[model samples]
Target: MVDGRRITRRRFLQDSARAASALALTAWGLEGARGTASAQELSFPVERGASLRVLRWSQFVTTDRPIFEQNAARFTQRTGVPVRVEYETWTDVQPKAAAAANVGSGPDIVIGFFDEPHLWADKLVPVTDLAQYLGRKYGGWFDVCPQYGYSPQRNAWIAIPIGAPGVAINYRVSWVREAGFDPDPARFPRTTDEFLRLCRALRARGHPTGFALGKAVGDGNTWVHWCLWAFGGRVLAPDNRTLTINSPETANALEYARALYETMIPGVAGWLDPHNNRAFLAGEISLTNNGISIYFAAKNDFPEIAQDMNHAVFPVGPVGRPTELHLFSQAYIFSYTRYPNAAKEFLRWIMEDTQYARWINGMLGYVSHPLRAYTNLTVWRSDPKALPFRDAVARMLPHSYAGRPGPEAARAMAEFVVVDMFADACTGRRSVRDAIRAAEDRLRRIYRS
Candidate 1:
């Protein structure tokens, strides 16, 4: 059964690749339409006699999995090649891939998060050449895509963003209205002082604001990065080389975070991503910052709460309103893949416009096309059911910031700064300043080691 919207083959492969690269183009200050390559340029000499194995997030595939069986059947029929897909979660997949690489049995294709390229640098094949190939086949790379997964020092494209989960403020419109507040743009809090006042007002009216502070890496790290940006703290220097988390601005940010923590629900320190989502869904909290997936998850399971919840662009911080653009688990090809060309072709196929629509729509609205052009589609941009989310993305894109690129630094920040310090501050085990200072010391030790 055809499950999603479809586009022509040429439009699927060629146009999509060009569109994907558009984000990178804009980041580099380039201007042009995407996908101007002729069909002849995209025609590849097929090496049909190759077989490949792929490993991906286990939730996306299964052996007894009916979905995997169906998709694999179609893939084999289309390519005339044997294919195997192994599935595992991020925690399981990384160690498995590492162990497999050591034993020379790693899968040909690997799907990992944006940090994976940096985390598994030794195992990755710099697919930076894919940009050139995309240019030849489609037209040119987008401004944002290249930046998301490329490492300049490594001179390789270790990963490609298949999707992006933009962050935003999720609030209950019903509660806000009942609390005698108009949260419209003109009246919305734009500064930290105003935000605090609003939170106090909401609290007086019995609406507690929720911010993710759980011990899980996903929510905890997100809290640190988003709060830091909101408070005008720089995680790294402009050159992407220096750790600037110990700056005065960072201290100020941490202080603000501590104050905000004081106003949050009592047990927020123990709540992870799902816990925060549940808090909002169960009407325990009024406002929180989270990924678009939370909305999808809510809408899928509980339509009543979904209708009451609305999304807004994160309030502008002292420096500016900076939202986190989270690049979730993405796909990559392994250097050890025996059929690199075929693997690339498979990637190209899946990323093609038609197949992309299937993958995305099938995911119950959890995924978003990373490119602006694709995001401009009717389903993404104009759907009435998604208007709030679409508006959130539009407002966030210009001011979006990414955390430290590599997994090592990101993990360190999560383990040290977020889980240890921030969580402690929330729970009153340590003051914010002391926690941040301790985190800085811990980070220095980590990097030095």
Candidate 2:
């Protein structure tokens, strides 16, 4: 057992491969459009003798990879097109996908993180037909769903908004109870002011808490972004034309993070996505923000911790509602595919009701309902433990906040601008005003271009 809490391979490598695609795209650059047509008539990819390739991030929920492969195998049986599937760590998927887009060859499809479809809109074929088909089969898209893949500029869907994996506050129930709060995860805390108070209490009881402060490909930037929006702050206004991050609400959020930093583990300044999962499982931390992988890991490897842990929505902020920016777990069909029809067919099948239910059941709460209609899957109602993560899509705010998610917002988040702003203040690299000024300056430059 590492650090006295048993660590499983799932917890260890889940995000190991999730959500770094856009960051890589930022450094190397390339990332998609929106359409909602339901016509599936395709003439290319010659249905007979066509083979397909699919590449996706290896999931934190260990069961997810195998579940997808099983469905792919079933698709091959049904369609006679042999499918080749490969899994990359989340970090590698972006760069690899970018390379494919750069050369105009490789996998027919990919699963990438948020705004990624926007980043590579120029290189992707619009999946309006597939998206519209699924939305009708399931319920209509979640509010932020269209923003992820559909761009009004091109009047097409550059990529499909497959699903979103939401991040929330994962904590040890026993520790919170010891801290004098009710043990129920739902009642834990729903406001920033109270969340900080809970952190101090847990720290006093010997289980120091944390979320990554460094540029964690996923978790680090996620929590930082949460704090920003919680206090009536946003990186951009609704129009996407003006920068709106330098405000009193933004400063209040940063100051709250500064206070939170003091109560966390000493090395969080350098921590990334996996650190919190490892820390919590090792019994080193009591609470933090993350997906359901923590409880999933504990259930399999550290049973006691499993019983003691649960995931919760972010506490209500000054806005008085959870402005959760659910992580993007979207799939895209690349324009380079010779088997475009076969690739689209595979996606359509995997997303259908029976197969979608099977895939989600395997991951349990690790993957939340991407579509509002898919919310009734047995996984949420079957297991009481999975209840808190069920409303992930419901709690979401588009990653761009009030602004439309497109090139400008995509560039800002991909480069981790707002994340750096909060990190700088917490790490003492910049005062609150300077950090906000620097972020605003950087965002203005991105939107101006």
Tell me the alpha-carbon RMSD of every candidate. Answer: 9.7, 13.3
C-alpha lDDT (0 to 100) for residue 344 of candidate 2: 77
TM-scores of all predicted structures: 0.78, 0.88
- Predicted model with the maximum lDDT: 2
lDDT of 2: 0.79
Local lDDT at 151 for model 2:
61
Q: Write one digit per residue (lDDT tens) for candidate 1, span 10-43.
A: 7679977877667555443333425564423332
Number of backbone collisions per candidate = 15, 21
Give lDDT tens digits, candidate 2, residues 127-240.
776766666556556656666767666577667666766687888888898998876866778778888889999999898998887767678867887788888898878877
Model 1 reaches what TM-score against the true structure?
A: 0.78
